[model samples]
Target: MFKKAFFAGIPVAILCLGLLTGSCQSTGTNKRDKEGFTAIFDGKTLQGWEGDPTYWRVEEGALVGEITPTTLLKTNSFIIWKGGTPADFEFKGSFRITTDGNTGINYRSEQLTDIPFALKGYQADIDGKIRYTGQNYEERGRTTLAYRGEKVTVNTQQNAADPESFRANVKNNAWQARQVTGSLGSSDSLQTFIKSNDWNDFHLIIKGNRLLHYVNGKLMSDVTDNDTVNRKMQGLLGVQVHVGPPMKVQYRNLRIKQL
Candidate 1:
């Protein structure tokens, strides 16, 4: 009887060992899926960022920027990330804003010498009213590259004698270089996905000359920039508080994965 019982237990022990090995493999695969991403914000302090102290701070685990009734801004200010210039990358974050807030995330940008913490490049625009949220606005650059719910391609004018002259002449008119390739959805319908006065997930996939923006897992804008003179391939990254009425904007969970 003892010999028979011992022989039967051997099969059960082998089956238990196989199950444990399978569980360990699954955990390792999950870690591998999240391997490349690097968190930019520490969530407790502004260690790797710079901006005007009067308007920017770390509050309740979020990077907060506010313009009070007394502290109105003369011009737009930005809190720039000191991390390496990411050329081809994926960026992810979340934001919440007041009803009248105007803020944006600037990437592939040049820092202005005249104004402290001023940047000019592509912006992922956000507003409390959701009017311009998810639009691609070039901050102090070519203005609107791709509005919400649109896919656009930017081409330089071949016959223009001067590229700088051409850019300045059509600063407000992006139609000169932009061609609508397709539509993602209606702007009003996309707005329904965003949360008012609550945190919403935002993502940007920028590779080569193509840039894509998404909000709450929905594609918001797409742009294929072929303009060599005006478009930037790599530069600094920052978040902005626009020059407007008293408003507040907060950002959290900032991370990047370089491609």
Candidate 2:
């Protein structure tokens, strides 16, 4: 009976679809999405990375950065990847953070001369709380370039000031030379898509003056830096452990595809 056989296969087809849904949600990106990307982390060791030994380590197949009360940091620190600088690229990684933890991925960034393992450049902001997550923050640079759900273009200033001075100016006036061109969604509404106290997928697509940050397949922030004086074309890549309460963050399956 052809009709009876087709109907019997329905339950099996539904079971296979359910299994796939769980797999994709658990890992964020599926195997097909990672086809061209190469894994930077080996899932077993910190082989090609450099950071303060006191804070970073490889644990449970992930690159882990933890700050204990006794080992709290006065300044933010980073674990830099010793790979080639990628100018135009797509990076995908999965991260999990503690309730109070703050961390980010820095690309097209420069390591500071005075502070070891310190970087200054555009950062894909991530925090245990979803408040600042999915934002584009220029750490030790222009500060907040674009908050979640914002699409902006940063214009150049006549006098290119240092990061500290720019921060001071923002504190006084809460202003920068950035113009909000569009909106992706409300910041509060976007948070509903992010998982709490669990692993989340983060993707950064950087090309020329444009940068995009996505979380769990949702585009959260988009920024275009028209300021040639302060923008970086290419530089180092690193992950940070912020200067705050004792906290922990882990990154796994770091893969990149250079465009």
Candidate 3:
């Protein structure tokens, strides 16, 4: 299932810590207001990461992901934040989505083969506008574990009904929280909040055998890493440009930690 090779996945998951939206967030275990941590992005330019900044851009002070109507941006570049790879890495941060549609971030991935998940690993569940806030569902693969309220049904095809009812719960055009974490090939896990045209904070934790998804600073989804997820491929991360609704989503304060 070998297809293409992404850029040389970078190492040193840099830390972009500071006051976001004037909340004075001391991210990182040491705290952003503390010491011994390094800054990954300066919030001015894309210096360390290398790739087609076509779909991704620096707007105002956030990493805005734009998809021009008819055009979509998909890259084959390994854009590293600091440089190098981390054996036990944990990526955490928040994104402010402006549009209310489908979009996502891909990580621990490699080349896309004919069968899909070629070098594919795990995808944090960001679909289903009908679910509650900050839910992590597996896409394109088997789900180790998940939760669906009795009122909600997860069909055999994994489809849901009354999605509009669920969509109504969204805060609309605001900042939410999201997170995804996992090791490259041999481990994977992801998490995200329900769809909202707003900003959300996320923290994804991934180790050798465990993957956790946290939304809105709450541990919403959690599961153990499996052999099915730990296959081949070690590619860089990518933000999605969905195919409907002429939508727009912005991701900012993206930071990853190496364990």
* Candidate 2 lDDT: 0.81
Report every candidate's CA lDDT: 0.81, 0.81, 0.43
lDDT of 1 by residue, 1-259 (tens): 0011110011121223222222222222112135555566767777768788888888999999999988888889898887556678788989999999999999999999987779999999999999999999998877888989999999875643375666654655454678999999999999999999999999999999999999999999999999886789988889999988999999998877667
lDDT of 3 by residue, 166-190 (tens): 2332233211111223221111222
Better of 1 and 3 by lDDT: 1
lDDT of 3 at 146: 37
Error of 1 at 220 (Å): 0.3
Pull out the clashing pairs in model 2: none
Better of 1 and 3 by TM-score: 1
lDDT of 2 at 178: 85
Model 2 off-target regions past 4 Å? 1-34, 161-169, 172-175
Per-candidate TM-score against the hidden true structure: 0.84, 0.84, 0.56
Residue 188, model 2: lDDT of 96
